[model samples]
Target chain A: MDTDATYQAPSVDEIKTLLTERFAGKVNVTKTETRRVYATLPKEIVHEVCEYIHEKLTFEHISTVIGVDMVDYMQVVYHISNYHTGTMIELTTNLDNHDLHVQSISDIWVGGNWHERETYELFGIIFDGHPKLERLLTPDTYEFYPFRKSYKLRGQE
Target chain B: MAKDVLDIKAESAVMDTDKMWIIMGPQHPFSHGLWTLKIQVDGEIVKDAEPIVGYLHRGWEKEAEARSYPKIIPMADRLCYAASMTYTHLFCMTVEKALDIDVPEKAKYIRIVADEICRIQSHLMWLAAVGTDLGNFTVFLWCMREREFFMDLNVRLCGARMTTNYPRIGGVRNDTTELFDRDVMRCVERFEKVLMDDIVTLIDDSSVFVSRMKGVGYLTREQTVNLGITGPAMRGAGVDFDIRRDDPYDNYDKIDFDVPVMTQGDSYSRYQVRIEEMLQSCKIIRQAVQKVKALGKNAPYRLKVPSNVPAGRSTVRLEDPRGESLMYLISDGTDKPYRLKVRSPIFTNVSAAKPLVQGCRIADVPVVMAMIDMCLGETDR
Candidate 1:
């Protein structure tokens, strides 16, 4: 009980290899920084990837979700962390431009509920299986996707 | 009026008393910020709590896309008025990473000093709020009296008292003086003697206070991580995880301090964790002050960089007084940021309240919430 387990965060390359070996070309992995590992998986495997990281890799918490409107398609970036290993993984999945929908990982991480809703409202990207998809920060009557490229700020001049 | 169309129940003509929806804010005494807690109550017990934020949302991310890189520092300070320095420091660090600017060694120590000081300030403010939430008016008075000490130190270090846009992109706005160091140490000493020793004993010894806090707001260890709870709240659940000790940002790795953790996972345990954390913050400052002093008084505090920042996307996360705050900034070779996404700690912490207070009694809601130490500015941002 007394021995504090000293954890050294794994290298990005190691995580890349681990994911590649596990998924076998189903996903693309890249390293933005030493501590941050970015993996771009298909929309179909988003929930699987989240479950793998949460249950298997022990990445206990989803830090937050960031949605970007990349013109051609919408992208949902998930910042997940494993407290024990002190590793951060950024998982990105693209959504359809016309539909702007993808699978929700809320059940994988209960904390993802509000984050998914925020993404749904701000970027207009829908989480397919979210229990309740509604506006969080914006007013319920307000119907603008504020984070999208189409929505402009008040003082843009 | 709410149930005008519903089938009539015995002795109830207008509303049903079985399961009622109660909007607990925007201006309620229980809510500290301009947000509502829609708690589904069945008489004395709370069935559910749905935290509704956005009452004070200013669309900071949308505004950041138009503003230049350096101008966002002041805006960040408003994210959490109670812990302005922490928010500003996280924002500066994010933008600095995007620009790849090197902060001076002196500035590194100074930023840590400012951050830990804000930790003390925030904890004291929460202490006062917690006291006010409970019927302990004396605790509020004593806490405000003690908070003035650090607020004085904050103003002395930075010109402004509360909204301190002190930490800049590269370093800080200015260097702190030798007198600032002396004043910080003096205040910390008095706080340890007065608040940590005397006031703590006065509160902890009260059987009523202890009984009220203990065994209330039970969040299991697994539930905490699953719900993304961090900071002192997670520590109270017996999870030994602190970003300072684990991540070791700025000069935290150089300093020696223990991450205070308790296993009770209740309001009382959270109270103890924060009180202990203030003492630890003071300890960190004690070491950080010496490190800053050893660097000599005339050492450079901030660095000079170009007016226009380079284009890149970078994100940085740091431990806030409540939990973790992150700023993800994207630049596109322009003076202004392409996009800036802020993941304020309270956003997730407050969201977790629904699950945490699921089966808690109606009376325990305020106690549970005050223990969360929410800042609506941060949550709604």
Candidate 2:
């Protein structure tokens, strides 16, 4: 429990500075609250940004990966947590309607593998370099992403 | 008459060395749930494993999108029957975050007590499962016997045993009933005595039980974190991270408890972690019950929150009995949520089955996975 004393974690302000200085125009810091940082980055640079975060910032654990259908565009949210500081950074990246492909961070954090698979199955967002991106909670033979807005629930108009 | 003496050695000379896949699940007694675990084995040693879930998937996230905020509380309860209150509490907390409101002190304390009670019973259920998995009926019966008292406490609190939809958006469904604190304290004290004195001796003192769980299904701290394992399993692997203590929510910060950590990172370490956690839950329940009593009976327990959540996104993660269960809410200024993503801890934990059971015997698979405390209700959700 006293592990926090060993690692010199960066303050939230320092993280903002480090990320902005590194990515510059490619990253946008959306919101910062207590122990929480929200940012949006271009889909093209997601893999690079995540690599930087994992290696430099020491965000070890990937909490979850969520895929959302924004009607016109799709958004994939990655919640990565730093055990040292008890801080979580929520990285949101929007995927174009035509191209729903984004670079996978599974190589950096193996924990994100299943999350990416689930996201891929549910929202049809393909992780470009995922090892085995298949339907997780859905049948392999089942077609269509059930979580999309276009896939209506039973009795729904 | 010669008992197949015609070239018996020659007939047995060509042994089949090929690895074969063993599908255990969807119906196997070892699986405890509807999921399937396909393990490729070579002469009884499991080489690789893959867990196939979603048999119990009810489209929980998609269903939440169709219902109003309040209606989802009951749905959340069904996520994990053993630890139903935690899921509902998480859903409520997530909604309250999206709505940007704080619950009353009394409500928070009461929730702490309830959540702790849920944790104890859930661990007891897991203990029972471990007992049966290890082929010890006495342990199973004893644990189940102890668990009944906690179930009674649940009924006393909210007239429900499992699938307790007691937590609501603003605070909880209602105030703690009369004598709820007294009953909780009594249950906690009795449970601690029985567990430490009798139950611990039964398992820890038994050579067979200890040997079965000791050196198998080992995971390093790195593998645990890299695989996204949480709750007691992560602590067992020596990660030393507990959402309640590290990232406190509700009245968890106010209450004092220790997050037991074990560095062995074996099946036995995981088992010991859960046992210690149940005792810690008792300590938390006692303190939280006292806090609730100190707040008096007239303090507000439930708040009248607005039905419609503003257009925003809020994420809340809590220390569920199983692991760190997170609910990410996306509201669109309507009574319903735009999207509600539930990060079920078991989902991530179960994903590590391949690594967990590899190199272990076929018979050891049940005990190894039992340490994971599988509950497909939440895993598939």
**Predicted model with the maximum DockQ:** 2
Q: What is the interface RMSD of candidate 2, in Å?
A: 0.8
Query: Candidate 1 chain B: minimum summed lDDT over ten consecutive residues — where?
Result: B7-16
Per-candidate alpha-carbon RMSD to the true structure: 5.2, 3.4
Q: TM per model? A: 0.93, 0.96
Separately for all candidates shown, the number of backbone clashes (residues 3 or more apart, or on different chains) is 0, 0
| TM-score of predicted structure 2 | 0.96
lDDT of 2 by residue, A97-154 (tens): 9999999999988888999999999899999999999898888998899999999987
What are the DockQ scores of the candidates, in order?
0.66, 0.71
Tell me the tens digit of each residue's lDDT in model 2 across B309-353. Answer: 999999999998889899899999999999999998989999999
Candidate 1 deviant stretches above 4 angstroms: A1-13, A155-157, B1-17
Local distance difference test scores for all models: 0.84, 0.90
| Decoy 1 TM-score against native | 0.93
Best by lDDT: 2
Model 2 gets an lDDT of: 0.90
